[model samples]
Target: MTPPAGYTKAKPGEVFRLKRSLYGLKQASRQWNKELYALLHSLKFKQSTQDYSLYTRTQDGEFLVVLVYVDDILVTGTSTSQIAAVKLALDEAFTIKDLGDLTYFLGIEVHRNDKGIFLSQRKYIKDILVDAGMEECFVAPAPLSTGLKLSPEVGDLLDSTPDVYRRLVGRLLYLGITRPDLSYSVQHLSQFMHSPRVPHLKAALHVLKYLKGTLDTGLWYSATSDLKVTAYSDADWSSCQFTNRSLSSYAVFIGSNLVSWKTKKQQSVSKSSAEAKYRSMSATTSELVWIQGLLADLQIPVSLPITLYCDNTSAEHLPENPMFHEKTKHLKRDMHYILEQVAAGFIQTAHVSTANQLADILTKSLNSSHHHVLFAKLGLISKVQLEGGI
Candidate 1:
């Protein structure tokens, strides 16, 4: 340790007194990350360029991967002995407790079988229900009601006693990790977090009701599924009644496994539905590029020209079209980005019917029957259905 800036006559071997700890400083996380990176580097592990939390190493055709989140670490690879050795070294340094196989991490529960792996949050859902005091609430066929209109000022403001609306919505946001079906509903309700109305509260409770029926539902990764990457992009033009901003939504899949999905409102208003869809396609393309880099870091090969499906024919042709019309002047940059990817053989755009667009669930509220159809196509399955081989 060095002496204070004003003290220039310090002893050669003198050290500053310990008044605080590295963990007590505001830069604790950054300091810890540097130390962890040094240790992993000493072990011949290279950090991922796509995701800083991920580390990987390969020796003698055996691969080892380490995923770190703060102090919690998830290690996996092709060799059990290699994993064990890595764990042994980590435990020696940090005094870690070996939890064996990953059955539960964060709030997600992992169930494994001969078929594949199923990730769920049944317990987390139940806890949310209890916290919301909706344990016995009636179930709804879908998370959000069809043709529902929710805005900032709809009804009387909610009581400020306990802030039930904000709390429930926050938990639902976390629950959305395993329940993509709640993406649209949760994102819609979250818009009113600052000043929630009675109608907004009721709508949030409706989402809880939907959760009651799908408590056991979660993502399933099939063992036999291929590694091909596919994506569905869709948008609801001027969906917000007040702001007139469109919603951009997309779903990404690896073979039959649903890996990522999102529903977000556009920052600026789009002039036409085609523009909205094009914006959604741009967001989806960015996600696909990140996924490609991540897979490369993991030593996984993905087929070139990843397929991107959009329901709008106009948006489909925008990527390959050579000319930009007068109405599309504002979208010139986006057009160039997509056109570059298309020209480089990184993405192939195609048109799909509205009925078959899986991302429709993330854009707007739909009827019960249609919502259920898209839900099933998302590779979501309940534990009972999985056990029965349904």
Candidate 2:
């Protein structure tokens, strides 16, 4: 094939040397990224380690976050003039298209209001629901039933014609960006994707039905909330019937806005509530330390002694006290790691009543009332209220 414009012609039986990277080449992405990163660095932008794609430059007390995805870049900052200057710099370096204020990126819809930025995958969810043939299905209050327990033995084998099960689960995984309520249930059903049974398919369909009702639901980042880092950690002992493993879950917030969270079944069984809770706290503490470092790099200063709330008081005490008893000795290693952070003033553990434990939603299924309360704490409000006032 003849070489196109901005390309060198190849000699007989020889490949054309690429002057600039293009898609589908082995090292094209890396080479293009190196060039972009070098240009940003020369413009006094510092790359973030927590998220390497995030680059920032602060001048005259204004902050700009330059998010790069291959050749596409999203620049968010305090001033339009500053953003324009950065765009000028990029234009001078390479061919670029400037897409004004981010409305869509990575499948999530961005909506801004006086309240703050609300992110949702409504269009993506609708598309998936239609693709799965569940667009008209009725919605349920929750993603999974509280009393339902799924096991490999519950249902018949799925059809052997094509791999419909794996494809469905993969699409649901992408839906998790705005629907954290589906995290645990999605992760559970994902285990059987290789050989999904009738029961697993039913459960997965139930999740789709729930999504049908809450298609417009998403995360709201409050503009008025203070930028203070606080986290809630909780665990459910022996929740997994298959492996008898405990589940650890944590939710981190900047004031009232939920920024990050996780739900994962533990590798090993915990004999006591304290052990389970300690493991959960350790996981949250590590995330807290990493977030602190990232914030430091962004020059966003935070107050000392970041607070971590735990529903188990025994676990909270275990970290601050060194007395190693029989019941606590088994968790000595996990205890010590979290305690080191406590002593270093990076994080401090505190006791929270289980009723007020927001992380409970992530660890186990909750009733409607409890779920509503936890969702409120996570900065999720009804779309009607979000649009009308609030």
Candidate 3:
């Protein structure tokens, strides 16, 4: 609230009095966040520790949840009467406008039916295509070219501004929120944000071509989905040619519906493939602990000893092996954290064949047939495509 120059009228020795300016104040956004939190808290909503923007209330067999994202508010409850009452109360307090059930939020589109809910960013992808001048480009079968290896100094620099490359990659990162299929490709492209090369831009365009034909494809949340959690962890050892770092990725499921996924290069190089796979398993176990905590907040009971599948047999037995210190002396100490969870009966490890591993799609590119099979299993069903027999 510092006053602008030339508005003060006083001697240097005396206090200079000036009008306080509220324009562009630092507390604007912070004050707004506090105001929203206080208003929701006054309505008996308990804020979530895992995610501060979420608030929940349960009383007399009625359950309600409110999620605030800046100025936008999403309110829902199990009881229709209770939801209506809350909407009315919020509208009266804030003089707000109610946008019915969430058909669209941010840039993603939502459609629901008897089977489940589907989320897609078809419009967003189309907009990106137009911006990149690829509206009539050729279609492809997958996001990245098969066996394509990208490196920091592999190709010539783009004649276009580096800012342009950074912006496109940034948008693709957000697009991966619902498109788990794009997780690996986007993460791979993100590595060269500082100095993008021709190979990287070409790889990004390949992803756009794949999206061209599959615009209707989206994540499906089955209405019958339960709280049962299952996860698959996988890795590609030394995939990064530049740094010799392995790629680690895992996918989490709520019953049969895929809910969470991630793909990242391992922080350190592993001496053996088993060690790399073990690191991936540790990451998956850590995510499960957090997921279970969130489920607890929702009053849903999670059935454990939760099953974790890994394609590598050694990594599968690493947690239960009593002599891990002798066999894996070279591996990082953090890799043994899962052993404690296994001993506590909170986790169970199982062996899964490479062909059946869902996390495979998140770690590396696959053939057209293989990609389609995993895509269908991940619940990326397209209602429009199914109806039209595409």
Number of the top lDDT candidate: 1
Q: Which sections of candidate 2 miss by over 4 Å?
A: 1-20
- Which candidate order results from sorting by lDDT in descending order? 1, 3, 2
- Residue pairs with clashing backbones, model 3: none
For residues 1-390, write the lDDT of model 3, one tens digit per residue: 434577575455565443543436786678777777887778888998877888899977999888888778888888889888888878887688888999988888988777677898988988988998889999999998777778888799986777878888998999998899999889989999999998888888888899887878888888887868999999999888878889999999989989889999999998788889999899999999998888777777989999999999988877877574655876647556888899988889999999999999998888888988998888897768545542
lDDT on C-alpha atoms for all candidate structures:
0.93, 0.83, 0.85
Give me candidate 1's TM-score against the actual structure: 0.94
Using TM-score as the measure, what is the rank order of every candidate, best first?
Answer: 1, 2, 3
Clashing pairs in 2: none
Which candidate wins on TM-score? 1
**Residue 165 CA error for candidate 3 (Å)?**
1.5
Model 2 TM-score, 2 decimals: 0.92
lDDT of 1 by residue, 168-218 (tens): 999999998988999999999999989989999889899989999999999
Model 1 C-alpha lDDT versus the unseen true structure: 0.93
After superposing candidate 1, which stretches have Cα over 4 Å from the reference? 1-25
How much does each candidate deviate from the true structure in C-alpha RMSD? 4.1, 2.8, 3.1
